[model samples]
Target: MDTGFFAPLLTGYEWQLSLYAAVGIAAVTLIGKYLVLLIPAFRAEHARNAAMRRSKMTKPHYAQNQRWNRRWGPVFLIAIFVGVLPFCLTAGSQPWWQMLLDIAAILLVYDFFYYLVHRFLFHDGGLLGGPLMWVHAVHHRQHNPCRQDSSYIHPIEVALGLGLYAGTIFGLSRVLGDFHVVTVVLTWVAFSQINLHNHDLWETDRFPFRYLATMSRMHHNHHARFTGGNFATITLLYDWLFGTLDHGHGYGKTKVAIRARSDASGIKKPPAEAGG
Candidate 1:
């Protein structure tokens, strides 16, 4: 809760609460990814993602995205551990219910702000002589983007994107007087995985899980069809509330819709689907 929380991480409650949450989440995610691969549905979803990227010929951008992610991803991790954890986390003062409430509030607040930022600042080029569009345009290159296209953005975008997520945590810290470490960690990890899943090409019509499926479709539509819609990150609630959520972009066959969108948006259309 104090200014210098980093010193405590090595030999204090920060180690047990914060690092434990992160490490446990990482272990579960890494192990669960493999475990889930055994499920036919999940395996097919992954295969669909890979095949979609290949069919759309997104290899060059995909490889470039990977390279940039590998470079900047570690910087992001350092920021999380050194900067964010210290700024937003406390050992374990808050009650479990309060921690849950804090996490929900943080996510809802972050998503609402991100919806505005993504739509205006990033999409329409909000600052610096309108050059943000040029930077954001790189991300729009892949009309039929998949999971690989998620982080394929400029370094400037990376920095600013990090700012928004971290800003939410630090900004809330002042208002809420420091959150529990587990609360911050779970909120951040959920924030991250949701972004990755947004670009995924999977479909799940099940209850709570179906929300992501719907969100993913909307995001793909943002890339492939309606470029100016579905700008929310964590949830589409803002999009719906702000009248930007677009479900009419789906035009039966996906490839045809994407090609049509490219022609309309002036992005170079790929070759016919016969061989594409």
Candidate 2:
């Protein structure tokens, strides 16, 4: 077989073009998200005060989280690429929409896996125990969750969360063919980018909350109160299906204290300021 003949076919248009587009999109998303957070540091007095307040609350923790991320994030990121590379190298060859659907499939599959894994790791103590809890516990400890410490997960926790999902995606791709790899990776990237933006306090005005409400609520509720629900990151369909949906008390301004009685009543109410 002539390998050289297939090289041009594979490298000609789809692979070269889509790969460049994805990289550019990913970079822009990262830069824009960070700028949104940093912008507040330069605004008017009240805005600067609020920004300083958030910086005080979050900057230190974020610095720490960055330390941990530098130590571990690259490892996991590399592992994910390595695990998914076999299938993804050829991902761009398909039509763009098919590529998108594949990405959606990955996002769906991983979100469910993440929900289940989080449930097991955080909620099930008998299996993994309390030490692992501390790492994750710190993330929920604050009323206003910081994006920096968001991924400061225990190394093992990161491995489990990322590795299993990547492995499962790898296994599924073996059967499903290579079409979805690029799309799946793209969707996951979109989810992560949005997740970071949602946590960024600086984006009070420009951030896209309406677009992210479904999945963002899960993390919001997770921080508001560890009510043992809202596990999915990119989609809440899993939570709604599994009965862990926390409608939260109100808009982003207030906090909602969930209770046994409240849970039993089954009445979804807007968040009250008192809870904050």
TM-score of each: 0.75, 0.65
| lDDT (10s digit) by residue, model 2, range 1-276 | 878876754552334434544575577667765665574432332353345445654557655654776788678866555435444445336788777766777778877887776765665423455445655665665555444435645666777776766775666567667544345546656766655644443333334544443444456656675544566666668877876665664222222344444566775553432111
In the predicted model 2, the residue pairs found to clash are 103-183, 103-184, 249-270, 249-271, 250-271
The residue-level lDDT of candidate 2 at 132 comes to: 53
Which lDDT values do the candidates have, in the order given? 0.71, 0.56
Which parts of model 1 are misplaced by more than 4 Å?
1-22, 51-58, 125-131, 203-209, 249-276
Instruction: State the TM-score for model 1.
Output: 0.75
For candidate 2, give the lDDT of residue 212: 43
Clashing pairs in 1: none
Candidate 1 lDDT, 16-123, residue by residue in tens: 455665786687678767987897777888898878766554456567666887798778767766656565667756688998989888898989888776777666
